[model samples]
Structure formats: structure tokens, C-alpha cells
Target: EAGRRNLLGLRFPPKYGGRGLRWEDEIVAIGRTANTASLNADGLGIKLGEHGEVHVNASLQTTIPHIYAIGDVIRGAGLAHQAMAEAELVVEALQGAQVDATSLIVPACIYTHPEVATVGLSEEQMRAETDAVIVGEFPLRASGRAVTCNEVEGWVKIVGDKRTGKLRGVHIYASHASELISEATLAIAQGLTIDQYVKQVHPHPTISEALGEAGWVALNKPLHVPRIQRKRLRK
Candidate 1:
């Protein structure tokens, strides 16, 4: 079983949960990953689906018994953090633990300058799925810390259900946006309301404060952006 388990590994360079490139031409031989199943998966009794992803049950187990799959082999954003979470979940499952899918809130981050990060539904997605939606967007120009670091070039937008006040999604486009999104992910995972999120008292003058500002803006109780800007924003 140990040898078979080793054969199931389709990952390369485990330091990160990402796809390894494969060249079709005979000129090169590379390991494929993320969207494609291992070359040996079919012969080993595993099923492949869209984009050549490994098919798994609700328990994350593959078609073959005792052979679970996770990380890039499964369907997801191919993110390292998400893969790590899946790894932990697989471990728990093997240990006879039962967990709900909602227990996992996978946050996506892009490590570029003025990084990009997001979690949960988008405004368009939320609008289509719910009756009413409200959005609060705060820009970096309003962040004192952004000015201090000369990184004022983006905004944070939060979407919520107007009736329930529950946050539907959180999007960030700013410096350290990747780092700032964790709090938003946690809020969404816990179903925190916009009011509850805003009242948390973010530390003064940091990019993270924008999250609180966005929540306040969503509630129509402006914190730092002011009424004049709010009026202009609506226009």
C-alpha cells in the first residue's frame, strides 16, 4: 500500500502547491501538474475529469479505496495555502475525523507588486445569487499607511447582503493585498456581518485598516472616507 501511495503522488517540488510544466514535443520531458492527472493515474484505477483533474469523493478519496487525492490534483485555484489546508483535511479524514466542506475557506493570493487577493463571491456572483447586495469600497489614497509607504494605488471592496448584513465577498487590489486578505477570508468563513467586522477596531494607519473602512462604508456609516467622497462615489 505504501508503494501504491507513492505512485499516487503527482506533485513536483512540494515546497509549493503548483503545477509543473510538461512539453509534448519529444524535445523535452517535463512533469505535468495542476490541471492534468498523472500519466499513470488511469492504469492505477483512478478516474480523471475536466481538465484532467483527479475525481474524488466527498471525503476527498479517489475512486480507488484508501487512495485519497488533494492539492493540485484536485479541483481548485492551485494555491499553496489551499493545498496545505487540503493536506490537513486529508490527514484528519484518515484519522476518522468528520468535517464539513465549509470548514475550509481557501483564500487566493497573487504575489505581484500591489498584490492581488480575494475570497468568497464577487459582486456579480453575489447579485445573481441573492436578492439585495451592498458594496463598500475604500481606496489606498485614504490610507495613511499607504501614504507613508508611497503605495497608494488600489482599493478594497466588500460586498454584503442588504437584508442580512452578512458579507458575501471581499476583494483587495493594493500593496500587500495578499497579506490583508486573510482577515477577510476569516470573516467570510465565520459568517461575520459587516457591522461586526467594522467594530473590531483596526490598529491605526495600516493597510489593514482599509478592510474596516470598507465594512463601515458598506453599512453607510462612514469612518475615514468622509461624506463628500461618499457622495462623489455614488455619482
Candidate 2:
């Protein structure tokens, strides 16, 4: 198995409990996490339906003053790291620091055949927030490093706050997108515009260069893609 199993406790099925002649085993570990709730009460909690969207009771609130909530309770991404960032932001706000909680961008990650990771606003959110949201996408097909690493089935997408050129989001679907997203998150955090990233000299023949290439697309100077021909009428 690809995952390591650390033993916490073991349990036998109904058969071993003096019932049916079936066999099953369950093991619970300290680090094991379940996206679903273990218990759902009448007044509070959530449960995932057959289709996987959750049914949540919005009346829930965290134990913090002038800091309403964080984590899965608020309906953003349910990643633990995202929640930690929100917690830190709330703490800073409660300390009378000039902090904006609304600026947070939740990132979603999935580790499957081709790793997936994303940060900041999605395409829909970008369209809803601004009229001039520009997206830059660079495929891994053109990446030399991807070829060298034997992993070339992914993409890097960057969403820029078009009016200000600020980086609004970055969606990385690659081998190590988890590690790559931090830089993008930092860019969004520091308010570094896409132009700044476009001017950056990324090291040669590396997966990170795909980030730089995507930035180039945002700047309208896509390096690998061929120019498109537009029909011109007689002036």
C-alpha cells in the first residue's frame, strides 16, 4: 500500500462480537482524519450527502471575541492549513493589528494519480469579483523539466486581478503542487503583481519555470504557444 498504517487500536466486526459469521476489522489511529462527522446531533453539526455536498447548521460559532469563526464551520475549504491561517489572522485582528480577514484565499489539494493543488479564488469567484479578471495557463507538455522527471500530465494556471495586475489565484496540478503553491500563496499574500513574476528569471529547465511561463501568458507574451490568426477585413 502507498500509505503507511500506524496502529492505534483495533476492533472486530459483528462476527467476533458473538453475532453473524462474517469477518471485518477496523483500526483507528491518532493521525487518521475523516472528512465526515462521527456524530450528528439535532441542534448542531454537518453530514455529507450521497453526492458529497454537506448539510451544515449555520448557527455554529467558535470561541473567540470579535472573531466570528474559522475552519469548516464557515463554508470555505476544509483544509487544516487553511483553517490555521484563518486562526492566525483572527488572532492578529483581535490584537488590534490592521488585518483583513476577507483577504484569505483557501487552497484545495488532492493527492491522486496526478497531484492537484490550488490557492486563492477559483475562476467563478474571479468573474464574480471583477470584470477584468485575466487567466494565464501554461501546460506541462511544454516543460522540459516535466519530461526529464517523467511527469508531464499537468498544468499551471494563474488568475490575475486584472485591473491592478495583482496575483489573485494560482491552480497547480502537478507532481509537487503542494510545495509549489506556497510561493504562489506568498505572491498573493505580498501583493506581488503578475508583471513582477513575469520579469523574474526562473532557473532554467525546472518545473518552477512553468510558473514563470504562466506569468508570461498573463503579460500577453506567451512563450511556447503559437500566435493565433485573426480575420482582418479591408480597412
Judged by lDDT, which candidate is best? 1
List candidate 1 stretches off by more than 4 Å.
1-39, 226-235
Least lDDT summed over 10 consecutive residues: which range in candidate 1?
8-17
Q: Write the per-residue lDDT of candidate 1 for residues 138-161, one digit (tens) a residue.
A: 878789999999988788899888
Which tens-of-lDDT digit does each residue in 1-235 have in candidate 2? 2232443344545322323322245545543233434334223444444433344332222322332455665555567987788778767766666665566655678886678888888767988876788777787877999999988878888888777888888999899888778778878878899999777777888898999888787667788754231111111
TM-score of each: 0.79, 0.64
Top candidate on TM-score is 1
Deviation of model 2 at 150, angstroms: 1.6
* Cand. 1 TM to true fold: 0.79
The C-alpha lDDT values of all candidates are 0.78, 0.68
Clashes of each: 0, 0
Worst 10 residues of 2 by lDDT: 226-235
Distance from true location, Cα of 128 in model 2, Å: 2.6
